[model samples]
Target: MNQELDSAAGSLPHDNFRCGTVALAGRPNVGKSTLLNALIGFRLSITSPRPQTTRHRILGINTSEAGQIMYVDTPGLHRGAKRAMNRSLNRAARSAISDVDLVVQVIEAGRWTDEDEALYAALVEQSSPRLLVINKVDLNKDKTVMLPFVAELVAKHSYDEIHYVSALKGQGLQELEQAILQRLPVRPPVFGEDEVTDRSERFLAAEMVREQLMLRLDQELPYATTVEIEQFNDRPDGIAEIHAIIWVERAGQKAIVIGNGGAQLKAIGTGARRHMERMFERKVFLKLWVKVREGWVDDENMLKKFGYTD
Candidate 1:
């Protein structure tokens, strides 16, 4: 049977077969979204240094002459004090690990913590085929510094394989792609050839605005903010009109978002409009309004309305 399996793998037409799913799991700020965007050759997911930036499971698909590889970008796993939002995010992250053809556990090459070890242990206990992906290799001046640590972890955990790559710089991605494709089960393409992501345009637009706000705002401002796309329309003149609402937790928060003489809101709108125009490939007229929605994040109904829950 071993010989037959090897022979079948060798004879398989790599170009004709469709690949399978590879889930990207990690702790917050470990660059999972960056890796996804880099692999798919586009910015499908909004990335920020802020933790819990990705609240949902985002699918990024890569198609080649060989086959298609679907990568799932999950929310970062974090230890919280049993808050509803925290619990939901952790559940979303773990959900990606189960029932997937391959699991790619992304870890920061520069840091090794007990938290990483705990998560690694859980993944191992599941007996799933997995790879330890060491992201952010570009930051390491001496790449060999991580080699010994990676080897120790692999030996201790008995991982199926270890892959080292700088996801931000696109290093070692081809090899990683080959490793993923080699493990994927035989299947047909799950989506069309032209589709790069599973998220809708409205979702992307809202995320883009949220990402900009997160980048621009400091203190508690980013945490208290939520963005919703109220209207999106494309005209025959190749222009897209977008209206979005930025919700804050308090009236004071609303004032901060609007800024002195509306400076901050205008800045966020300008930045978001440039990105939206580039993404939609048309002129974007974005209208943003601020409203105070008290306790929106913790409110279950509000969370469901925002698609954080179904």
Candidate 2:
């Protein structure tokens, strides 16, 4: 894995500078990944419209003159997780918030569901300072309507601070950042100034391919699929050579992923390769294969092998 910091290492952390880890906790489809990317000023975590798209605890680092904030983007804490993989996701999400310096509960503006309430209950048990981030505020044209909802919410719940912002449009983030920095303890930076994340290119490669699967596959098919990077080698020719396998539970699912005349597979490879080149900052030669791993999602050992467990 390449851990080299970029040339522009930015300003060093000065006296009284605050630094700590912050966990973006929320229910599924609440735009936590988008908020993480926006806060870091880098596309470190993959995003899709699907729920539970983030299955791992990904750390994104943002270093500035003020301080270095290590943001942990976690999987959504959802209910009714019957499968082993789903259970693992909840464990990862819960584990991430336990050790973080601050917990930011992100939810869509003007709406709060049962899942949101469930996650809030979990956050109450944590010792970290909690903040409420109302994301997707841009979607609500009638801003006045939110006052009653927020009022009712504050009446029943408690938060150190509440902020409204649209993660997609990058709105009202400066205030949120300042509030977060103020809450963190004054300490030196833990990561290099130029580092955006601790994740390696190898892990990111699998995620890029899985993002494509979540976007292109229909219905429940995406949930049954996972990506494995069989090989990720930076060739002497200056091109990243990647070999990946798309694991499905059934042969029928494998046929669908491969598609007629291999067109679907081709499209997945093309899309994932383009993202890899941009994120890796190099040309990529990607090759993909679809394989059937019967009942991998429910098998605990298989889930661990696929990097689903913490």
Candidate 3:
């Protein structure tokens, strides 16, 4: 596609300093998480094929000689706000674009839908500089169509720049990083150089369990399912202990998560623990329990209790 990081750093020294926030905004499943992970060179956000797999404003802090690129990886900005939870997610995504140095609007290559248009309209209302990112270019077979498609996108928004990338395979990411770095404000870094994310250990652990449920359950997934980290401890013997509760919106969904003879829960726990061990780099003991909390996604108080916005 348009593979160029020539301007991402722009004649700057290897130790040039730049640091600020860049909000990655797009529709659900548009590789926003994949792009964030690729840019940061680590897994700060969890990913699955499921829509709304990410519900929070995940930050991935990349501090280098070029300075800190503090990215705010937000959930997809969508129009369907039928549920309180859905509205909350939209709110979080919308809030990310405000008071930010740059906004990178990620869209799938060679296609534009109404949802994409809606998000574009929202960004146009904001004053922050925006870059148009056409992701998943690897999936587009006909390379010739990319030019015309990019031309059409150029007419759609007043973008400062346009980049094409394959977030999954790390194509054109160097260019993406350079483009972002050039736009970041010249200020002191906001986070520690060693820190990858602002989320705590408990928050990331809960997300790991939730990611497992989405991957394993498939169609049996609950609309309002979440993981609560009841206990997280690191023993002196080099074992990490974690107890997480899977909260579902319905009793039947809870049963489905647990599966027949508790086999499903066990399988899900196994998958989650493997990921946990890899993230923590230690032997992990993960305990999971399922509970049904009907209509909790719609209740403001319950939403707050689960670390969700009302």
Candidate 4:
């Protein structure tokens, strides 16, 4: 893995290669991040059972013999974004969709909510070719029932192509990839084949800790918390040492995160460190601390400081 990361052997060998950006657009909890990881064959983005798990625009690159596809996984766009952080997420999602080679609107296999309709309306305004991906098809046991749902959708809206995929099970991905490649223009690959993402290891460190928070914290507590990396250093002995702070909105939340005898914090750190070691391919020693910020979610300046703004 280290050797592949250090080499740049995958380049465009032919002039007919197709390379461009594709934004995975959708509402919350619709499997957009899952689709991205499956397509790129790398777990660049974090995932949980929570809505709005992705808060920023993440770039995952896939380079093959044929072409390189840059996949932008954006935060799920939704309505009634009243909080400053929620609005910031919406801003990131909207900004990501505006400048892309293609837009893939992902939705659940058998259901389309108002948020999906709203996103479709937004995508209709874009000049880029749009594709509708009905994800989580594995959950839909009866395939015949999807005919009418798709029939109604097509009658009311338009898409350049429609595809059904199960991102978790890796179904129907080849055809989707072919369709996406065919629509992209012929150009040289922008990134090397071995490169999986454009994000830094520091940025990914914070995300890995936050993924554990989302999975372990109860309702509403996870949304109120954000992880900040204080230090990430590679030691002389070749081990990575990291110190992180878990910022919450109130003292009560902080206590809950710390738990009785620091059990909760220990669990969170252990989970995050394991994932970091796996992804970074190194030994990771992680330390965590809980802190209160007193409504940082509503403070715009604090949001900017936390790297929420572009």
Per-candidate TM equals 0.91, 0.96, 0.92, 0.96
lDDT of each: 0.83, 0.92, 0.85, 0.92
Question: Ten-residue segment with the worst summed lDDT in candidate 3?
Answer: 1-10
List, residue by residue over 1-310, the lDDT tens digit for candidate 3: 1113334333334444788899999999899999999999998798998878889999898877787888889989887688888888998998888868899999999988888899889998898889989999999999999988888878856899889899999999998888889888776666655678878888988888888888888674645688889999998998999999999998888889999999999999999898888888899999899998888889878888889861
Task: Compare candidates 3 and 4 on lDDT and give the better one.
Answer: 4
Per residue, candidate 4 scores C-alpha lDDT tens digits across 1-310 of 3545435634356578889999999999999999999999988899999999999889999888888899999999999999999999999998899999999999999999999998988888899999999999999889999999999999998999999999999999999999999989898777777788988899999999999999999999999999888999999998999999999999999999999999999999999999999999999999898999998999999898888984
Clash list (residue pairs), candidate 4: none
Higher-scoring candidate on TM-score, 1 or 3: 3
RMSD of 1: 6.1
lDDT of 2 by residue, 1-310 (tens): 2234422432474698889999999999999999999999988889999999999999999888888899999999999999889899999999999999999999999999999999899989999999999999999999999999999999999999999999999998999999999999998777777788878899999999999999999999999999999999989999999999999999999999999999999999999999999999999999999999999999999988888877
lDDT of 1 by residue, 140-208 (tens): 899678778776776777667778899878998889888888788766566655668878888889988
| Model 2, runs deviating above 4 Å | 1-11
The residue pairs that clash in candidate 1, if any, are: none
Clashing pairs in 3: 8-178, 8-179
